[model samples]
Target: MRNEKMNTNPDAVRQPLLQVSNLAVDFGTVDGVVHAVEGVDLESAPGETVAIVGESGSGKSTTAMAVIGLLASGGRVAGGSITLDGRELVGISENEMRRIRGRDIGMVPQDPMSNLNPVAKIGTQVAETLLAHGLANRSTVQQKVIEALSAAGLPDPERRAKQYPHELSGGLRQRALIAIGLACRPRLLIADEPTSALDVTVQQTILDQLDEMTRELGTAVLLITHDLGLAAERAQRVAVMHRGRVVEQGPARQILEDPQHPYTQSLVQAAPSIAAARLQPEVFQTGREQDAAADAVADNIVEIEGLRKVYPMRGSASDFVAVDDVSLAIPRGKTVAIVGESGSGKTTTARMLLKLIEPTAGTIRFEGNDIAKLDRAQSREFRQRVQPVFQDPYSSLNPMFTIERLIAEPLEFYKRGSRAERRSRVRTLLDDVALPQSMLQRYPSELSGGQRQRVAIARALALSPDLIVCDEPVSALDVLVQDQILTLLGDLQKEYGLSYLFISHDLAVVRLISDYVCVMKDGALVEAASSEEIFTNPRDPYTRRLLASIPGNELGIAS
Candidate 1:
């Protein structure tokens, strides 16, 4: 439970913290003048949170960037007035903005991995903020850095400070970003999708930390996110953006319960968390939904026993066990999701199941065949039987290749058909994923985040594999696009009788898509049960805490 309450004092705020009126921003691109934001009006008071919700390319991030005076080249304020406590910031000089940035305004950018320098130590990054702002002298900077990390919920800040960005888990990296954002205790904090990359438990911890700190410091938060549930739960006021304009703005509860705009209504109804079709067997299953209990365990498509993976320490004789005696079963044509923190071995188990990584001790039976004992020819065939959709689509996709080539490469690798035939298969996969055939000629950089993920899914399905391992497929997408991808996967599963070994940290998404749920922690399975049992009545303490951590779990909103 939270030790303190924040977002609890609306009446205490009398003075306006940030005010933006009739804001308009545009980018001069090679295509032409692109109007990113138009006629936007928003305000936030001290000790308050104003959430701006929208899908990607809906001007939410652009508005925040314009307010922060960090808009990239070719982008300028076409029309608008941005003021902080009566001080104009839109036309401010860079040097002046730099002084105001950390001292008066702090920001937590969306992408933690790219925002952080790969070569620098995390401690140095945190200390640099305090030193640059003249908040602390060199003598006390190290201690201040450790304190910031500790406050951000990172355990053993002393050791964590020396590690680089790659050495930490995704959750730790996000918390590091948070520590940097709040190191100066700025009057205004611009947080853009702060918890979008973290697991549920870690997301709650980070949000709680932010709420407490902001409340204590009287900092106004301008949150830019696509999660309607998060806005409904944490924000004092909600602003919904459609296309390039704000269509609705009001109290959080009022906006979520009774949205006035059609765009807002569509967003709420399309979200997977609202109805949770995955936990309901009747909705997720086919005609045999009622007979699931009567089905035998032998109906599983993949079975594992005593799975263990150990990696040797750098210099020590000891070894690190990533997956410890983990066992699970994936029923034929059923979706079983594994949920856990980043390093909890969910990905490791999935990798082993796909034979991408070998297990030190265990037996993985795929269709009653031991994957470990497969010969060269059999292994080659196994590659065609199983496919994987990685977590990061941009990294997974090759920038040099067009979307068509990326999808056709798998078909060509397996020698499934001729050049013309492989081209036909790629088109069919594009149609199945709801992508236009015209997009085949474009490179990965030309597509948006959601479109790139869709292309990745199309590539994964090019082989028509019997089992597909989707690792955090929809974590980076907005709720509307996430729902579309989920629906596509479900439809494909039913049409092709495909089985899925889904791995994700988002429990709300897990509950919405999985027939069975497996909870993992510290490289072990803490609990495994049907989706309904896990969501409705989790037995394990860890599982219960996880259930309690879903964003907006405590709120009750009307339809």
Candidate 2:
């Protein structure tokens, strides 16, 4: 553990470079004015990192956006004092703030897909930042852009620079954002869940590089993340936020190890850690019923043998093998997790199982029948029985549809019941996912990330699917919401005898939910075992390295 101490004394001679006092932010919505952040006090010295940890709606990101003077439309500071090098920023003009944005205070926003310009080349974006900040001119911008991308740890910088944001992988897009944020070497950096899209090993590498770069420049970092372990590992101080207020703020170790606020304590409890045991649902705790149910089926529900997917390159004879000889099985009413880094073929394998894409070579059998061999009617039945809960709920759900329509779409699609019955089924699903009936008329945009996810789950369960392919279902959610979603899945599994083919880069999350684990690297399965055996005694070096990359693994925090 790092032995750094926070300077908390009010009478101290040294002053913070970035100071936030009594900050409040409000958003004007259709309902009325909503206070998104209130009375939040935080500060960070040069060469220091301070993290704000909270749930999805806790206003951590709002506070960071406030600091950068980039609040969304309909949002206003309301009341606050934000000082950068003793200069007040609240009343500054947009032009002045623009000047300060890239040169003085950099921002690495979440959601690289939305943040990065789809039409712009990667090099153009980085160059724009450099040129706008007067760090480089037109003549020198290209080299500087490549240098920045290289600094952000992007491989093949020259080729990557020429590609558009859409052409790069999620991890690459995130790195490009990081490159832009750190291009000018700003005095202060606001990282709003900057590494959320990255894999654990890449996350560690990026954070390490960020640490080194910021240290050299004496930059202050205001990190907003839902990840408690990452906050504890990377930041010197941690602030606990709840319902737009800073409930507690102190040294990282003190806040996480001995959380004072009730909200903070709940966050610690809900956060999935490597030290935590596999969470058992109420039904599973008493193994008698579950054991008997498992015995009755006595066979795997889905099996993959020599599954391989190859993408032909545009101009080359060689093809890209996304999933190479991936073989795994999902038992009835059990979770079989595929854990790997980005581009390691976890999602590819899941897509194959879903029949979204065909395999170049291999077999995917569902209930002793090859999915590829299914006829039209059989395929329709298979589609009803096998469903998917995607990673980003906001993207997955149709914004035009109400919660009722979204959940009941599948029921209506297969014409399972009358309109009244489908609506009734939607209500039942809402209860199954622990959502209120009042949400039926609400749009997807009106709900929080967790609520949106519940709705997605409800939609998946609309047809009473035997198997649900959950592709990083809870990765975008906060700790509390992640725990809730996992619990709901477990309960639903027990009740409906549902099987799960789970995919995630989060090892801790995988540890909590998975029954069996398969580790993949470079499009190949490196290791497979029971959850207990895999985590307790990983056989492969790649698996061990993945485990070791988990943030705060060294702290040994009690789960």
The TM-scores of all predictions, comma-separated, are 0.95, 0.95
Ten-residue segment with the worst summed lDDT in candidate 2?
281-290
**TM-score, cand. 1 vs. native:** 0.95
* RMSD, candidate 1, Å: 2.8
Top model by lDDT, which number? Answer: 2
What is candidate 1's lDDT per residue for 26-139, written digit by digit as tens? 999999999989999999998888899888888999999988899888999999899999999888889999999977999999788989999999999999999999999989
**Candidate 2 lDDT, 1-559, residue by residue in tens:** 4324333244421578899999999999999999999999999888888999899888999999899888999999999799998999999999999999999999998899998999999999999999988899978999999999999999999999989988887888999999999999999999999888788999988898778865677788889898887888888889999999999999898898898898899998888887777776222312244346556765899989999999987766898999999887788778889999988999999999999999999999999999999999999999999999999999999999999989988888899888889888999999999999999999998999999999999999999999999998998889899999998998888789999999999999888888888899989999987787778888899999999888877665311
Q: Against the unseen true structure, what C-alpha lDDT does each candidate score?
A: 0.85, 0.88
Query: Against the hidden true structure, what lDDT does model 2 obtain?
Result: 0.88
Off by over 4 Å in 2: 2-13, 281-298, 557-559
Model 2 residue 512 CA deviation (Å) reads: 0.7
* Model 1: lowest-lDDT 10 consecutive positions: 279-288
lDDT of 2 at 459: 96
